[model samples]
Target: MANVTKLRCNETVRIEQARIVALYAQLGQQAAERLMASAIEDLAMHMVAIDAAVQKNQLGAFDDAVTSLIPLARQVGMTKLEQVTRDLRDCMRAQDLVASRAVLARLMRIGDRSLSEVWDLEDMSI
Candidate 1:
C-alpha cells in the first residue's frame, strides 16, 4: 500500500487590527462603525455574485466580482480575503478552471473567517 499524506489547504485568515483602529481614530467611532457596516454588506453581496459565477463557470463575472471585492477588502483590513480574491482573479483571467476552483474554495473559507473577525471587532469599542 502506498502511503498518502493529506495536505491542509486552508489559509490563515486575519484582519489588520491597527488599520481598523486607525479608521476609528480618524473618523470617530460612530462614523467608522457605519462605514464598516456598509462595507460588510457590500462584501456579502459580492460574495454571492462570486459564488453564482463560479457555479455557472462564468469567468468574466467571477473576475468582475473579485475586482469589486478587492478595495472593500483592503479598506476593512481583510488582508487574507483581499489576497485570496486577487489570486482567484488571476486564475479566472488565465482561464484555468481547476486552479480557479481551488482558489474559489479558499476564498469562501477566508471570506467567512474575515466576516467573523469583523463582527468580533464590531462588538468591541475602540
Candidate 2:
C-alpha cells in the first residue's frame, strides 16, 4: 500500500488594522466604506482574470493580472496578501509552472480572506 500525504496550506492573513483606521480617519466613514467596497470588487475581478489565465495556461496574462493586483493590495495594507502576490509574480516570471501552481493557490486563499477582512470592517467602528 502507498501512503499519500496531503498538503494543507493555511496561511496567516495579516491585515494592517492601523492603515485601515487611518483611511477611515482621513476619508471619514462614508467615503472610506465606498472606496473599500470598490477596491474589494476590483481585487476580486482581477483575481478571476488570474484564475482564468492559470486555467488556460497563459503565463503572460497571469503575470499581467498579478502585476496589476500588487499595488491595490499594498494600498489597503494587506501585508500577507501582497507578499504572496509578489511571490506568485516571481514564479510566473521564472516560467516555473510547478511553483506557480502552489503559489497561485496560496495567493487565492490570501486574496479571498483579505477581501473578507476588509469587507467585514465596512460596518464596524474602527
Candidate 3:
C-alpha cells in the first residue's frame, strides 16, 4: 500500500506535457503564453501565502492557500504541485501539524522544480 501511494505521488509530481501542448493547440501561441504567465504569477502568490501560513502555524491560512493552488496548478500542468498541495490540505484536515510541516517543505521543493521545468519548456519553444 505504501509503495502504491509512492507510485501515485511520483506520477502526480510530473507535469503533464501533453496537457500543456493541447492548451497551446487550442488557445494559440500568444494566448497560451499569456495564460501561462498569469498562472505562474498566481502560483507564486499562493506559494508566498503558504509560506506565511506555515511560518505562523495557521492552518486556516494554509488551507486557503492550498485551495487557491489546485485549479491554477492544474491549468498550468503542474501536476506535482497540485498533488503536494492536496497532501498539505489533507494533513491540515487531519490536524496533523507535523505531517503538514513536512508536506509543506516538500511542496516548496516540488513547486520550485515544477516552475523551472515549465520555464525550460518555454525556452525550448514547447
Q: Give the runs in model 2 whose Cα sits over 4 Å from its true position.
A: none
lDDT of each: 0.89, 0.84, 0.84
Highest lDDT model number: 1
lDDT comparing candidate 1 with the true structure? 0.89
RMSD of each: 2.0, 1.5, 5.8
Off by over 4 Å in 1: 1-10
The best candidate in terms of TM-score? 2
What clash pairs does model 1 have? none
- Candidate 2 displacement at residue 20 in angstroms: 0.8
The digit string of per-residue lDDT tens for model 2 on 25-81 reads 999988887878888888899898998897788988987888788888887888888
How well is each residue in 70-111 modelled by candidate 1, as lDDT tens digits?
Answer: 999999999889988888888877888899888888888899
The alpha-carbon deviation from the true structure for residue 96 of candidate 3, after best TM-score superposition, in angstroms, is 1.2
Ranking by lDDT: 1, 3, 2
- TM-score per candidate, in order? 0.88, 0.90, 0.84
Question: What TM-score number comes out for model 2?
Answer: 0.90
